[model samples]
Target: MHNPALDFAVNKENKTITIKREFAAERPLVWDAYTKSELLDQWWAPKPWKARTKSMDFREGGRWLYAMVGPAGEEHWAVADYQTIVKHQQFIGVDAFTDADGNINSAMPRSTWDVAFVDKGPQTLVECLISYDDLAQLETIIQMGFREGITMAMEGLDELLVSIKK
Candidate 1:
């Protein structure tokens, strides 16, 4: 697989995690990979952890429910509640840990995500801004290895895009 062009930063002042990445695919293709469940399943999680969507509706007020199954067969459920969608351009949503039955887990940190897909001729640049409720919550996730996990997941996305391009 080709190396991923990705940048991950945590802003202390804004209390947010921002990830910037460039993919060889066009904006529409990148957008589809994000909004379409089947496409997301191919690259959403890190290796040895497959993503399975329980249900998805790609629109404002809609939700994408999924689970990340580990090599040991452990499943971690999560849900993304969409707040705004701008077709192949951008989308904003709130993500939270949840149960298989779609019940939120209050003990987990929740994050608001703003994802933008910028057209760059034959390539697309994806910027993701993730905000936590507070510094404590932010620290919690960072300590949990969020950065490494997301970096690995984005590399998976890079691989998926390369396969599609071929």
Candidate 2:
């Protein structure tokens, strides 16, 4: 088995972050892991933090509302509004921190995410581009440990793929 590396880059001038990760699974399975709420809840959050979806509608113009629950039982909610979707290939969405009622938190940073899945023989490569409105918003997320959190979450996904492959 090949060990895939995660490529994460921050482009300050563009106010965006790009992440590329290769998974040992095929494109269809990987796409399901990302698009299905049940599958995502299994590996979306870092350890000691659990993801719980309150509601989800995985169509264009629909939204997913979920919370990342801490070990202490605290919850941080967020919503991802899907703008576009192309089965097994790509999807675009706007993500924002939100209240439990699904109201966006204006003070928090919001971003537009473009995620693509590509077939690479036995593996699937996921490319993600996240754009913020400005550099300040990008900086805020970075300072809040976005890099570390996402890296951990991806590692969780790696474990998930391996277990589900059998």
Error of 2 at 123 (Å): 0.5
Error of 2 at 70 (Å): 0.3
- Candidate 2 residue 61 Cα shift, in angstroms, is 0.6
Highest TM-score among the candidates is held by which one? Answer: 2
Q: Write the per-residue lDDT of candidate 2 for residues 127-161, one digit (tens) a residue.
A: 99999999999999999999889888889988999
Clashing pairs in 2: none
Residues 32-151, model 1: lDDT tens digits: 999999999988988889999999998999999999999999999999999999999999999999999889999999999999999988888899999998888899999988988888
Highest lDDT, which number? 2
TM-scores for every candidate against the unseen true structure: 0.95, 0.98
- Distance from true location, Cα of 6 in model 1, Å: 1.7
lDDT of 1 at 92: 100
Q: What lDDT score belongs to each candidate, Candidate 1 first?
A: 0.91, 0.94
